[model samples]
Target: MPHPATVVPEIASHLKRLLDFVDPLPGDVCLDVARGRGPLPALLAPHVRSLTAVDAARDGRAFRTGPVRMPGDALTAAPAAPHARADETGHPTVRADATALPYPDGSFSLVTARFALHAPDDPHDVLRELLRVRRPGGRLIMADLVRGNLAATSRDRIERLRDPDHPGIPTIARLTEMVTAAGGAIRRLDVFTVERPAEPWLADAPDPDAADRVREELLDEVDGGPPTGAKPRIIGGELWFTQTWAHVLC
Candidate 1:
C-alpha cells in the first residue's frame, strides 16, 4: 500500500478541481458536509463570509489546519478557533449528521460534500437537507468515488462486499436523480475519469526495503510479475481511478 503521504499530491490536485467546480461567491455562507480533514472548508474560508465544517466522526485534531478545527456537534453553538494562518479566517467546525443539518432553512449560499456520497444510508434525504439550508439560487457541489471506470473487476469486488459503512458507489445517473429530486437545478455536470498510474514516483523508492514493498504491492500485478527487459521503458502504471468533478445549482 502506498503511504497516505505519497498520495497527497494527487488528492490535493483533485481537491482543487472539486473546488473549482463549486466556484463559491464572495461573502457566501458555505457548509461542508462530512468535511473530514477540513481541506475543502479551509479553501473556502477566505473566499466566503464564513465556512462551516461538519462531520460525523468529529476529530478536532485531524481537521485543525491553522485555526480551522473539527466540530463537536451541529446543535452546539461553539466559536471557531483562532486563524492558524492569515488565509484561514472565519472557518468554523461543527459536528452533525449530514442527513439532518441543524441550521434553519436557507442559511447558506452554497453547500458542499466531498467523497461522502458513499456514506451508508441513501444520501437522497441528506441531499434534501443540504438543499433545504441553501439560499435561493445557491449551489451544491459533490465529489465522490465512482464505480466501474478503471479496473472494472476491482470496482465490482469492492461494490459486492456491500459493506454497510460504505454503501455501494453511485453512478452519474443516480447522482443526477438525487439533485433533481431535491429541487436543485442541474447547471453544470461533467465527468472526468482517469486511471492511476502504475509506475511509482521517483521518491517512492526511498530505501531498499521500501522499494521492495512498492514493487510487490504496486507493481507486482502489472503483468503478474516484474517488468521484462524492454518493459521498464514501456511506462507501466497502476489501475486506481479518480472522478474529476461535477456541480448543480440549488
Candidate 2:
C-alpha cells in the first residue's frame, strides 16, 4: 500500500470536491460504495449521521479510499492505505456486490460510489441498485473514469490487459444517459483531469508481464502507433497520461 502521509492531501481534495454537490446535513446517513479502500472514514464520517462502506470485490480492486480513486485495475501493490479499513474509519463495513446490495429501498439519505461503475456487466444495474437504496429526495452521487477522445477500442484493450474485469470507461454523454435511464437525475456535473505517471499506477498489476505489455502499448501510442484514447505523453522522460473523471450528482 502507498504511504498515507504523502497521498492523503491529494485524496482529500478529490473527496471534498465530491461532497461539494450537496448541502450535507449532520443527520444524513451515507453509503460509500467502494471497490477497494482508502481515507473515507477520516474524510466522510464527520459529515454524516452514519456511514457504511461496502464493495463486491474481495481483493485488489481500485482503491477509492475517498472520492477520487484509481482505476479498478490500476494499482495492486501500491494502494493508498491506513484509511482503507472501516474499523479505522469507525464505520460499519460490509462485503457486498454493488449491483445487489443487501440494504432495503430508501435506506440511506446519501450514496456515493467511486470508481465502481465500470466493473459491472451493466453499469445501469449498479446505478439502479444505488438509486433503490437511497431515500426519496436524498442525495446520490457517483464518480467514474471518463474516457478521452481517442479510440475507445485501444483504451479498453489496455484496460482489460491490466484487469479483465474492467468494462470500458464511459464517455460523459453515455454515463449521463445511464444515470437517467436508471431513474436518477443529474442535478450537477463536475469534470476534471488528473495527470499521473504510468509507473506507480501500474506497479501492482495482477500480472507483471501484462504490465510490461501495457507499457509497450501505451508507449506505442506515444510513438504514433495508434490512438488509444489514453493520450499518452512523456513528462520528464517518464510516461504519463491524463485521466478524465466525472462526478455525477443526482
Candidate 3:
C-alpha cells in the first residue's frame, strides 16, 4: 500500500517489527484479537492468506485501518476513526470479547494480540481463551507494553488518566508467567523500546480534560517533580517518552 500522510510516526516501524517477529506464513489463517482502532490488520494483510479481526467494540472503531506505507514512512497512519476503511480488502470481523471468543477449538493456525493485553481485566483468562482456538502446533503470538525502565506506579497513573479502562501494563516476568499459566510454553520473547511524542500520544485520550491532566503529570515528572515513571523529556521542543514492549511468540 502507498502511504501519503505521516499520521503516526512509529506505526511503520512498529508493524515491521511485528511482521518480523510473527514471521507469518503465506498459507496461515490468522486470528487477531482485540482489534482496537489500530493499523495492524492493514499492515499484516499482505503476508497472510486469510485473516479475521475480533474486537470488543460495536462502533466502527474496529474497522479503522492504518496508513499505507513502507517503513520509511515513519508511522504514517490512515485517517481518523469512523471514516477509515472497515478493514483490509474484506477481511472478516467478529464482534466479541476476548475472554469468551466464539470460535471452535483448534480453529486457527495463528492467533495474535498486540498492544491489547493491558486493557483486559482478566489477561490470564484472555490468554487461555486465545490458546483454546489454536490448532495443535499452531502459534499464539502476543505483543504488549510491559513494565520497563520507568517507575511502574507513576507510569500507570499517566496511562490510566488517558484511558480509564487501561489496566496496568504487566512486568516481563509476570507476563511470561501468565502465558505459562494459561497453558502456553515459552518459545521466544523479544523486548524492545519505542519512543512516542506526548502530545500525539495523549491526543487519543477519550476526554480532553483527562488528556490535559496526563500532560501535567508527565510535565511534572520532567520538571524535577516526583517521577511519573514515563521519563518524559523534550525533543525538538516536543515532549517524548519511551515505552518497553515485549513480543512473545508461543
Candidate 4:
C-alpha cells in the first residue's frame, strides 16, 4: 500500500477540481460537511471568507496533526488549542451529524459535501439540512461516487464490503431527485471517471474475507469476462477500475 503521505497530493488534486467546479465567491462563508481529517477545511480556508468544517467523528487528533500541504507550500504544524478547535489557519472544526446540522437557517453562503453523501442513511434528509443552513441564492455543491449503469449492483456490493459505512453508490437519477426534493434547482451537473489500482482501494476494508472476495471477483471480471458493470480492467500489470464521480451544483 502507498504511504499516507503519498495520498495527500492526490486528494488535494481532487479537491482542487471540485473547488474549481464550485467556484465559491471570496466573501462566501463556506461549510464543509463530513470534513474528515481537515484536508478540505485547510484547503478551503485560504479561499473563502470563513470556513466551518464538521464531521460525525469526534477525533480531534486528526485535525491537530496539521493540514495537508499543498504543492509548493511548506508543511506546518497544527495549532495547540484545547477549547478552541481552530487549526493554524483559524478554520474551526466541529463534531456534528450531517442529517441535522446544528447551525441556524440561512447561516452560510456556500455548503459542500465531498465524497460523503454515500455514507448517509438518509441522503435526502442530509441534503435538506444542507439547504436549511444555506442562505437564499447560496450554492450547494456535492461530489460523490455514482453508478451510471443499472447493472452495477455488484460494484455497489463490493464497495459496501470494502467500507461498511458506504451505504451504496447512488444513481445519477437518484442524485437529481434527492437534490430537487431538498429544494435545490439543479444548476449544473458533471460526471467523470477516475481510475485507480484495486489493492490500495481495498486497503481499509473492514473485513479481510470480504476484501479477498472482492479481489477475487474483480480479478475474475477483468479476465476477459463480463464487464461487472464497474469498468474493471488490468492496466500495465495492475488491477484497475473506473469510479464514476459526480459533481452537482444547485
- Model 2 residue 86 CA deviation (Å) reads 6.7
How high is the CA lDDT of each candidate model?
0.52, 0.68, 0.69, 0.67
Per-residue lDDT of model 1, residues 1-250, tens digit only: 4332223245456556666788878878787876344467667766777776776443332211111122321211223534222222333445667777778899888888765555554678777887899888777776565433332344323233222134555556666776788767667765765333323331322254543443453345444664321122123232332222344344
- TM-scores of all candidate predictions against the true structure: 0.64, 0.78, 0.80, 0.80
Screening candidate 1 with a backbone cut-off below 3 angstroms (N, C-alpha, C), the clashing residue pairs are 66-84, 67-84, 74-95, 197-238, 198-237, 198-238
Cα displacement (angstroms), candidate 3, residue 62, comes to: 7.5
Candidate 3's residue-wise lDDT over 11-98, tens digit each? 6687788888999899887877764534566666677777766655435442111122233321113222232234453334456778
**Cα RMSD, each candidate:** 8.6, 6.4, 6.6, 5.1
**Candidate 2, 150-176: lDDT as tens digits:** 436666677778766667777777787
Where is model 1 more than 4 Å wrong at Cα?
1-7, 58-92, 147-156, 159-164, 194-221, 224-250
Model 4, position 179: C-alpha lDDT score: 84
In candidate 3, list every pair of residues with a backbone clash: 3-68, 8-75, 9-74, 9-75, 11-75, 67-77, 67-78
lDDT tens digits, residue span 70-148, model 4: 4444211223223336545444546677787888899999998766566534778878998999999898887777878
Better of 3 and 4 by lDDT: 3
**Count of backbone collisions within predicted model 2:** 1
